[model samples]
Target: MKKRILVVDDEEGLRLLYKEELEDEGWDVELAASGEESLDKLEKDSIDLVLLDIKMPGMDGVEVLRRVKEKWKDLPVILCTAYPHYKHDFGTWASDAYITKSSDLTELKQTIRDILGKKP
Candidate 1:
């Protein structure tokens, strides 16, 4: 079965771009505009992985990552952000991987494949 990936980001354009990009690569993509919504989706959907953005309006990605890990220990989350400094924050260590946002998704897609143990 195709893996289900939840793409969480406040920016509508970025969210849509990721959905389209990842979907084209054979992933079943779901979108969440906020941390709260992402948590709700996690409860309702059988999500295989999460591509989470760090900066948001309300509950930030770090808090969301904390809660996600607390509830789903085995769920793989990749911290996708513009700021690479968060990688130094201990809170981000709980995530399976950390990726800085880029126009080219090669690294992002490769990271996802690596975390999911899928062949290139």
Candidate 2:
């Protein structure tokens, strides 16, 4: 089965872009515009991994990550954010990988493969 990836980001453009890019790399991409939606999807879907963003209006990514870790301890989560400083935050330590947002997506894809134990 194809790996299912849940992308949680407040920006619509980024979500769409990631969905398209990840889909091209043979992943089933699911998008959630907010932390609440992300949690909902996690409950309803068999997601293999999560690409999470910080600095949202409602619930921040760190809080969402905490909730996810509480419920789904084995699920791998990758923090993909514009702010690199969040890497220093203790809350982000629970995540499987932390990546800075970039248009190139090369690093992000590599991280995903590494965490999933798949060859690129």
Candidate 3:
């Protein structure tokens, strides 16, 4: 089965871009405009992974990452941000991986592979 990924970002353009990009790569992608919306989606459906963007209008990625780890320890969440400080924050939250918003698609895909590696 194709993996389902939830893409969370407040920017409409970026969210749509991700939905299109990841979908083209054969991932079943869902989008949420904010962390609250992302959490709502999570409550309604199961997602294999999360492509989360930091610096939203509210409920920043760090808070969402913390909550995701708290409620769903096994879920893999890759945080994308345009800030340098988030890398440090991600380490503290035990995030699966942290990618700068300018990150190359190849690296993002590789991180996903690494996280999803050997999973039954």
Report every candidate's CA lDDT.
Answer: 0.94, 0.92, 0.84
Q: Over 4 Å off in model 3, which ranges?
A: 90-92
Highest TM-score: give the candidate number. Answer: 1
Per-candidate TM vs. native? 0.96, 0.95, 0.90
Model 1, span 31-79: residue lDDT tens: 9999999999999999999999999999999999999999999999999
Which candidate order results from sorting by lDDT in descending order? 1, 2, 3
Q: Point out where model 2 deviates above 4 Å.
A: 118-120
Model 3 scores a C-alpha lDDT of 0.84
Worst 10 residues of 2 by lDDT: 111-120
The candidate 1 region of ten consecutive residues with least summed lDDT is 111-120
- Top candidate (lDDT): 1
CA RMSD of all predictions: 1.8, 1.9, 1.7
**In candidate 3, where is summed lDDT lowest over 10 consecutive residues?**
84-93
Error of 1 at 101 (Å): 0.7
Q: Please, what are the lDDT tens digits per residue for candidate 3 over residues 25-100?
A: 7788899999999999998988999999888888888889888889999998998888867666534357778887
lDDT score of residue 47 within candidate 2: 92
